[model samples]
Target: MSTESNSRGNHSAENGSSVHHVVQIDASFLSEVEGKMEELPRLLNRSAGRDSCCIFRVPQSLSEINERAYQPHIVSIGPFHHGEPQFQMIQEHKWRFLSDLLLRAESKRVVLKDFFEAVAPMEEPIRKSYSETLEFDGQDLIRMMVLDGCFIIELFCKVGRIVPADLDDPLFTMAWVLPFLMRDLLRLENQIPYFVLQKLFDLSVGSGNDDPSLAKLALGFFNYMVQRPLHVLVKYYEKKGVHLLDLFLMSYIPDCEEEVRRPSRFLHLIQCAKKLNQAGVRFKPRKTHSILDIKFKNGVLEIPVLTMDDFWSSLFLNFVAFEQCYRHSTKYVTTYATLMGCLINTPADAGFLRDHKIIENYFGTDKEVARFFNNVGKDVVFDIHRSYLSKVFEEVNEYYQNDWHVRWAGFRHKYFDTPWSFMSAVAATVLLLLTMIQAFYAVFAYQNPPKNH
Candidate 1:
């Protein structure tokens, strides 16, 4: 009887423990469901009021095309890629930059603490600008803004020649690093708010006679990297940008012309430069630094010279990614890339542009240069009707579509495409010229007979 009672009691105890475990799990799941249910209304409200997203993840569809171009290799700029293990190498450099900035401001008695104070209050507004709610709390986000903003200012200062570089500075002394850093800084996900940097600039370095506006400084830095003059965009300096990436985007747009209306969608498969050359379309190099200054008028297609090197892909891909994520942003860069892709379908097309001085290929082969454009627009969806290049595309396509243009192109390719054929044509021209001169002399002698006198 005692054994039976003990067994029964043990069984009852085991059953109770099992029941308790099940109840606990049920309670935890119910709590989670309730929490999500409670947050639905607030989430909807937040979604409705969202205006612009400063930083964005490169769309996975585009990223999968070439992950390296969308991702940072040597450095990560902002909070999205922050704490990444591979990017940790640059964190020390960022800290060093921060230290240098503090020391430079020592005379003004500005410390790191001052940066924190300025950034902390602006944290909420800054967060509001991001499309996705950040996983970081206020303190963490502020710290990131402070550190990243200072690093960028210091970099721009160095690049803009506003300040002298310290001895053994990696950014100045290590040549390869500058390109990577510049590429990384322009990534869509790799950016901090420009206002934070500007605020920090005022707090640490007063806006005095020598201190330039942040726009000027940023333009200077971009111009240095691109080796193009972006001074035309100085008028738009007072315009607000969400971050450094947006500032970079804004630099490409020229002031709107009153006469020209941008179309929504333009054709892409216009004749290549080589074909266009045959059709009597003149390719002239525009001396402007604005990348979007492509204009087609009266058979002349004016395009700014584009330099292609190892770093161009990284810089360009990031710009396209930004256009992809933002609805309100203009698709200028995307349109340009698509146009280039259409125009440069092969090495022959790239060589034609290179010969015309419209494209300056720094170190890449013609095929590689051609490939850059051909692959750049993959997975990026754009409405041609709303594109800045729509009008240019329409004009170019219309011009190339003429019956005369096609016949002329065919004539050139058949008769004058090869060197031997061109030489043959030149020889025939010389012979014809001699014959015409002989005929003219004979006629003159017969008509005048004045040579005898």
Candidate 2:
């Protein structure tokens, strides 16, 4: 009995001892975690010291609303959309374009290896250009850079007529493909670095490239994409562009003048075209091709002619996204789009612009154009203070808000909206004038008796 009691006592003692055992944390585990925390700041400093990353994934705030807007519809260019199965068909065409480019370069003694070697050294810088670190190895990246660079250069040459068009070229032969390609190239996700293209062009064409500079050829190609017949005034400034979308944005912004001075603050509520018209304000299409150059003077708002097409919404949304993403980038395109959105609230407003020949609507009905302007800037955040047309908007809005302007506008709209109404107003004015003359004669005759003389 005593032994059995001692055994129970020992078991209880063993369990109590096990329960009180202390855990010892390894010093190495703690050190490793602390080391990682210490390394974070150095990593950030290293990234900051490097050249600013240019290419970026579309901010979720911008892309989440319309994921398709940033995606290429017809073709993919860079690593972001490289492996998508839907865009795989165009890879063959890119290779074809590269082959054609080499054939054309034969006269300049340029071979495929020369192009590949030229782009090899640029791989590191090119990878750094993208905001997100690309996960491609040296060989894969170099190959992508070479192929994409050649395809872009060849495209610009073909579109600008720098090289003779191939008879069986799909881009030229198929009428529907060109417009889609233009839209695809301008997409935020589907862009290669412009430097890559320029370098490839120099290597392939030597000094034989017709255009004086690569910028000129690129601007010319942009004009073709927009289908504008006028020559765009591209300043010979050394602004480094991140991608095709960046280039397109910079085309409208003038050098040395980043922001237009905002007019002094006042009631800035710009009326629609119909309202402005009724308020005795005039609308005229400016001869310039820059859509950002909207002006107002002497009750005349001179807006540059805008071409609206099937791709207008996609083009505009991407432009807005680019402006939203970049810090140094101006909100000129955003402002222009907002102004258009303000001016055209409905189909009637669109018709008013069309009647003034300010907007060429190649899309569909006025409603579609109106809706296009209204929705293009969805999820896009912009500051009006930075808009170039701040002053113009202020003036237009203040002018439209004056009590006299409102009354006159209302009167004109109420009484003179149609030809019959205008004629009736003229007739009433004439009758009032005759009545006043008769009354004056009666008063004069009764007071001075001038009739007797």
Q: Backbone clash tally for model 2?
A: 0
Tens-digit per-residue lDDT, 1-453, candidate 1: 367766776787888843122223578898999898776342223532456455777777888777888777778776678898998878888898888789888889888888898788887778766656677888888888888888888888877777888768766788888878888878787877778888988876677777688877876776657765445756766665778778877877765431344442335547678777777677888977676789899878999888887667777888888877766677778888888888898999999889989888984899988878888888888666666666777888778767887787777777688999899988999999999999999999898886544
TM-score, per-candidate, Cα-based: 0.79, 0.82
Q: Which stretches of candidate 1 lie over 4 Å from their true place?
A: 1-32, 37-49, 230-240, 256-269, 277-280, 412-453
Highest lDDT model number: 1
| lDDT at position 128, candidate 1 | 64
Q: How close to the true structure is residue 450 of candidate 1, measured as C-alpha lDDT? A: 69
Q: Please estimate how well model 2 matches the true structure, expressed as its whole-model Cα lDDT.
A: 0.76
* Candidate lDDT values, in order: 0.77, 0.76
